[model samples]
Target: MKVRFYFITITLACLVLTACNPQTNQIEKTQAPQVIEWEYQIAYQRGMEAVTWSLPAVSMICMRNASFNLGGGYNTVYWLSEIPTAKQEALTANNQTPYANVYLNTKNGPVVLDIPPASNKTALFGSAVDIWQEPIADIGPAGADAGKGGKYVFLPPDYDGSEIEGCINVPSGSYQVFVALRCIPIGGATFKEAAEYAKNINAYSLAEINNPPQGNYIDIAGKHLPTLPDYDFSYFGYIKELMDTEPLQKRDMVMGGMLASIGIEKDKPFIPNDKVKSALTKAIADGYNYLEYMFETPGFSLIKQWEGRQWMNIREPSNDGFVFDEGEYLLMDERGSLFHWATFFPRHLGKATAYLNAMQDADGNLLKGEKQYKLTVPAEVPARDFWSVIVYSKKTKAWIYNDLGRVGLSSYDKENMKLNDDGSVDIFFSETAPEGMESNWIPTNGEDFFLLFRFYGPQESYFDKSFVLPDVQLLK
Candidate 1:
């Protein structure tokens, strides 16, 4: 009876110790690995999309900042006498047009942009974008002014004034504005002439227009502009800066909440815990890979430009000004993919310009510089202003450098090129030009490259799919 009592007592004591001991309780609490909360996971995903979608705008701001740092400072227009060839470090830049840019900060009040009348052979276009890179308004030839010289007043978002006559009112969503102007020198006018025309463009505050500061132009022809951010944990820093810089629009509220959940709220220091930091780093990398996959795959909502051809348009033809039926909350993947493909360009659609890119030849093989290929442009290439075909490095997305300084062939220079017997033009891509066909050859210098076919002021044929661009045919 004593042994039984002792054994029973011992068992009871063990049970109580095991159940009530602090160490045991602590061990039980940590027995299973910590699982991330569902809410946290959802927040992470939304944050990833927010970052990806905002990357294009942030990248443009970074580019403008880089330019300001390199070519004088803000409010000073940087003019590029030479077109952006592959040597230029801009993001997916075209090599056919000379450009000038000025960064505007209208935190105090309105700023005035004085656009000069373009010469007869020059077509100039200017667009003012907020810090988020959203297009506020377009000036110059294709813009509201219709190439006539005028003063464009960039008003703040909270402005409550009556409309000013004579001056075009541009309401900016953010105080920081980027004004990029493209000057196309046509009809034998040189880039020097284009630079001269760009120099005449000026920017000043409406309050100081009477005694405005002299316009400053810094030539950035061969200078390198570092615009791409390091694809790592530091990218979040850029996102934070962008969030703080741009005013929160209604469309950004959801994203802002997501960001706040991750400790990236505006006006607050972003300090993610180790677990969240790890998750975010992985998420960013995954997002980039996903975007690259979208670029390679066929289902990015890409529009088929030509039948039996590899050329594809990145954005849908029917998208209203790059906005879908959902307005700002449109398809995230499609919009993110478009921005990833080309970072710093307005979504002007087919009106201002139509863009088509070809990565592979008609045989569906990746384009290589060691091989020769030909693209035959049918006569009357349906561009109201002009058209150009530029070769860009697949890896860099910049102009492909070669022995020939030419990175693009434009219709403006068609008289200097050799045409096919049928009035169509055959442009060749190869490391070596054929005998007497040098003018038609665009040297690739043994590098993998892609082609960007641009139609400025595209006609109805391009939109109707009637102006089909020929496939790139590989030649021995």
Candidate 2:
């Protein structure tokens, strides 16, 4: 499994220490070592590394391609006029609120994102990310504008900070940018009503900021949108496209160089030969399985939210935004595992929202479909907006398909859901309702699943760990 680079590293280290001869007491002129022959194992190990490196970028590409498929493109705005359903298959997508999304291409020049301020009826909550899924700016009240609304200019790598006036200027390293936001119903307004009010937000070329064309808008609510990355030789195609399209980051020079060994290069047309194709196909599968193993690993110190409970936060609460950038080296696995189950990395936490995950039950067993489980939420929740417990299939990281067409339960369903004598709520997960608990049930549909506890507008207790959420307990 040793690649040519591995041998080079070893050989260089040996030369530095052992190349000095005792007889001469001097450093000898070293002869160049032969490069190791390439093989499937070499490509396999490198491909796995590439998957970890490329997951974030590839996921962004998947959504951007979906944007084009939905009759939208760079600068064309699309939104879910209603809450998302299973039909919208992006990773761990929220089913609670309406979503508005737009992709921007800054290859030619800068792009302008015009966000409307928090009004009487509607306010937006979300972030804009570069193609790497790195947060560029946060939107809405808790964001860059602080709810007053401002024009955000996405400047390209080549653009200087000159003559750009009266707007938030965001300098982006990658050429492509994705902006996604949720429409929050405000001042007693309804969710759907707020979606209509969100039409005021728009993105266009900075060249036409003065006379921007009437914005393009499409409602992708009921569409069967597929935004998951492929795990085959085709995955390399995404790498090739980015190589041809965007600038190679300084940090990624090593991975970019390794990609060349497997037939992906910017200067050359991406036509993989039989040998490269065979190596890549197997590499992707192995890479994905390794990532799956990382995701399923329990009690990893970073993801554990509550010390005593199985509830986990993908980004360690103290580490905001999951950058994993330690200045010495990028914690690739931390970033990879986080994006493995979710998309749309947020800029901040505990102010607008907080997400905690649980794949195992109280006894430390993986959540299963054939089994029944129940989680009890305390009477006092820290979310000012709302709290929801969502279930997604472990295989797809997407919503499960059940006859009831339900994915999760939220505080919004409190009236229909039965509560304990103490006012705490019991939400069940099984093939069917737990006797009279039909209103509180989230169906598993015979598929192994995981849970996402979302606290929207989470209060201080959530951050201070005073409001501890309980684990899902197995039912007899």
Candidate 3:
């Protein structure tokens, strides 16, 4: 009996030893190193995509906050009396037109915009953008009135109200909408006259239009507004704020899941552990690097308009509303790249404007401020309304500040500029104006800058790849 008891006790002791051994415990509790590494990598990749995909929304939130800080919050219009000068706080602005805008929140009910009729040479060109900066509708010109101007109602996504007759209905995809208006000074109208016409533009809730208050106008000219997101881990904070403000759609669920994986879900406190924080930091850096590379190396082929001239059309020719494949699957990467390079406003081919940018000079070198260059714009620029070329800082992506205080040259000012014998206009870019070329000079302030060529109301020539801009040539 004692021998039998000794054997049983020995067996129990062996079992305990097996359970307590560190190696055995590790074998049961730990995952394979490869598995853990793969999980981490997947998390990192999703984090990167989340940041890239949410850039537009984050940009909207940043702009909203900046506008609020600049004294115009929700439901108020901020009017720029003059064209955006170098000191104007904006992501990217043009000196050709006076700007006025109002941020609308239609959560409670529909908001009514009373766009005054175009008077004389003053006309308003407006566009309504959702939270993602997707073009909801063109407001003034290229809208239902075709620049005649009329009352327009912006309804929320969940709006199920009776249709009101006579008013153009603009159904928005999100609760937050931005009505960006530009006052074009045509027919020799002055900027001040155009600004006065912009000030007459009114926006108010349908419930309060009968007793509407005087329009709140916050002049943002020469004032600084921080519209760009902080390019760091803190950028996630802006994303979180955007998620909280804008309701997520069914298509955005995947993005929401990705954001949640990085501890940035809506209504949740974003308190990430050290490991997660480190992973997110690395992901942001990787995303920026990848996007920069993608911008430099054109992923989509450019439709060469002229020999040796490459102009990239941001929108896909076949697709209109959404960027989808033949299978109807969303091209997330392509969409992300387009928004990263330019603004979030995506319009249809015909009603929309086209943008072309050049970072390098003709000699394949970065455009430096200290160097002198010339760009000869071909005659008969094919734009229905107008066209302009604006120089911006490569770093800020905003208008370059210079001693001259000029940000752009427009076709409207063609009379003042000298045209070549062939009718092409030569534009000069230099720190100092070339002799007898003050009218064509665009100052660079001795800092690196890039060019943005805008074709507002682009015609068939632009889409057919018939119109091409000349390269910037280095002056001898």
What lDDT would each prediction earn against the true structure? 0.77, 0.84, 0.76
Q: Against the true structure, what is each candidate's TM-score? A: 0.83, 0.89, 0.83
Mark the regions of model 3 whose C-alpha exceeds 4 Å error after superposition: 1-43, 299-304, 321-327, 344-346, 349-354, 363-366, 383-386, 412-423, 430-439, 456-465
All-Cα superposition RMSD per candidate:
7.1, 10.0, 8.5
Q: Which parts of model 1 are misplaced by more than 4 Å?
A: 1-47, 297-301, 314-319, 324-328, 343-347, 366-372, 401-403, 412-419, 430-438, 445-447
lDDT by residue (1-476, candidate 1, tens digit) is: 99999999999999998889867787678788778676557645865786667776667766776787775776788888876655566656766678888888777888888888877767777677776555777777778788887888888877887766778888888888888888878778887777667888888888877787889888888777766655567878888887887777776677788888888887999888876787778778777787767776676646656778899886652345554324535466665666665653554766677889888899899899889999999888889978999887765566666767778788977899998788899999988887798988888888888898999888988888887888999987
Positional deviation of residue 25's Cα in model 2 after best superposition, in angstroms: 40
Highest lDDT: which candidate? 2
Give the worst 10-residue stretch by lDDT in candidate 3. Answer: 297-306
TM-score of 1: 0.83
In angstroms, the error of model 3 at 221 is: 1.4
| lDDT (Cα) of model 2 | 0.84
lDDT of 1 at 465: 89
Clashing pairs for model 1 are: none
